[model samples]
Target: MLSTEDLALLEAIRETGSLSRAVAHLGKAPSTVSYAARQLEERFDALLFDRRRYRLQLTPAGELLVNEAARLMQDVARLTQRVRQVANGWESRLWIVTDELLEFETLIPVIDEFDALQSGVPLRITQEVLIGVWEALREGRADLVIGATNEPPAIANLRWMQLGEMQWVFAVSPRHPLAKAKGPITRAMVAQHRAIVVADSSRVTEGSTYGVAGGQTVLAVPSMRAKILAQCNALGVGWLPRHRVGLATRLVEGTDRFI
Candidate 1:
């Protein structure tokens, strides 16, 4: 049986189009890679390559093997990624807590991207309040945490990767009485309507660092789903990500109460 290293060299040589280049890439002297190839030629008892004046050309059998080896190389790459992820506690082992309200716009896309790129690295995510998400990560209850942040990041043990600017928008259910206007919503108008807002759990500070306006007081709801559910009742307005905006709520542009 050919050693795995032998198979790897075959694939690498095919990829780089030169035995010397493959040896250099693998940090092996040219002679070592050449010896491996010679061993394979002897085992098969057939000329796999036709040496030319200036370049090496694969014979028919050699070309066929290279094509088959390409498939094996892909499998090996994915396996290697899984092994690395497992070694680092990243494979089948990501725990995330985030606002359920941000599902459509931000959450789903982020989850999809990681899963696709990492392949076998499965992610286990939880939907929780902004504050609860922070607590989950901080208390070692979760692996990754995300929510609104106006100041510097605060998770001490876990590292945070910023995903660009997360923008907040105002959404009122389509069934609301004032759903038909182009003018900006005043804070006073929002107070007159029922309002839904996400509250942090034990880890979050009670007041807004982003600040709220329009005389609209926020009713702190626990998780993202709960906030959306409450807002879905058509009795109130709430904050939502633009990526997740839906038919139930129309975004109130300016002068809308948001935090």
Candidate 2:
């Protein structure tokens, strides 16, 4: 049976790409590391490393073992963390709903920090738009909601906090007629073209829309990012979050003139 140390040794060699480097990382002498690897290989009577090039390359059998070991180690880690969490009386799961306007990438560091705590609280994240966030909380679909824009309805036992304001700007592609139209754009001018809008993800609520003037052709998208891309491509025109406009500008700078 392979031990955790043996699996760790395989992982180190895979990461460093050299036994000498891997040994330094493991804080073991080169000879000792080599002896351990050889013993492991001999137990199965199969070559673990190619040993042809100067670099540490895994053989077919070695590759298989290392890959399987990685999954096994992940399972072991999660199991250990879950046990520790149960002892500490932590929750089994946490459901979170975030507004579509907020960038999900910003939550990466927060998720990493949470994982480090070994809280064993499995996180389930879902995206919502406008009133969908409130619907999620009201219907018990989510335990917490982030980036809720509107005031919650008069309901008992509801809690909320302000998370700052989100700025929006009406944008158009330079190739679009509105971009070249003289003076400020009016509702009539906007009505002549298609408006890009993200569909609200609320199931219970009827959902909401903004900046779509009366009689304007609507092109509904799944996410805020998609709406921005549609506008950049001149597929439709609509308001986009201020910060996302910069990225959209860069994306279409060379190929298309995005205003």
Candidate 3:
């Protein structure tokens, strides 16, 4: 429970190594510094100065106190700064939920930029699919949501902006029948094959799916990446983000759409 003044007095005495020099360094009278030094030792019930030494050095106990107290002061300063930041509208901890359709790797640069700010707010990033992204924000499970898909639903105090649109391509494994389909793949034709889909993570709300026709057989997977893998392995066919399709899968022509 040492006060800042006590810490400063100890530091000055240690640094200067003489009562007269410590008083000069502290801009205090010699008698005042001497009396304060004696009070500090009495309060702690430990000899803090090596007065027997001609140079007036600090005892080991005094050195330990100064070093530990300086470290504690630094911790207090950091805690104070974080408290003020929270008071100024920064969240003490941030939980960000992104749609599983959005690759987590794409947000690395933005995360690095946030780290550079040294805001001291802890960040938690998670992923949800389809309606689950919106549900996370609505249910108070998330503080921020990134790359959420579909029209945003009504939620109290919700705020958002369009990051950008994603283009979708109907993709399938090269060995799949659709890869060699003769003409434009109609909704009827798509319905004939099992559609791979990432299941919505929503618990409270009725979740939704996209691009699947009525009565179509579905292979519900855990994430968009799994859906892509299922399609690439000829497990099923479905629309996928164009950027994620790559050469491993063939894109069904004439079905490009933006969302």
Model number with the top lDDT: 2
Q: Quick one: ranking by TM-score, best first?
A: 3, 2, 1
lDDT of 1: 0.66
Of candidates 3 and 2, the better by lDDT = 2
235: Cα error in model 2, Å? 1.7
TM-score for each prediction?
A: 0.45, 0.65, 0.72
Per-residue alpha-carbon lDDT of candidate 1 for residues 1-259, written as tens digits (9 for 90 to 100): 6567877887887878777778887899888888889888998898877777446678899988778777777777778888887787654567766655445355777767775774676667676554555666667777766653533346665565665676667877666765765698776666676667666554556533122456666677665556666666665676766654553343333233333
| Clashes in predicted model 1 | 4
RMSD of 1: 10.1
Tens-digit lDDT track of model 2 for 1-259: 8888888898888778899999999999889999999999998899999888988799999999888888888888888887777788876688999998888888899899998976768899988888888888888888888887789876569888897887899999987889999998888999999999999887976788888998899999998878888888899899988988888888778655433
lDDT of 3 at 6: 79
Lowest lDDT sum, 10 consecutive residues, model 2, at 250-259
- Candidate 2, overall lDDT? 0.86
Error of 1 at 89 (Å): 7.3
RMSD of each: 10.1, 8.1, 5.9
Better of 1 and 2 by lDDT: 2
Question: Can you write out model 3's per-residue Cα lDDT over 1-259, one digit (the tens) per residue?
Answer: 7877777777676577688888889998888888988998999999988888678877899889877777776677778888999999988899999988787778999999999999977899999887888888988889999988867988988888988999998887877998899989898998999999889888876688888999999999997767876787889998887787763343333244312
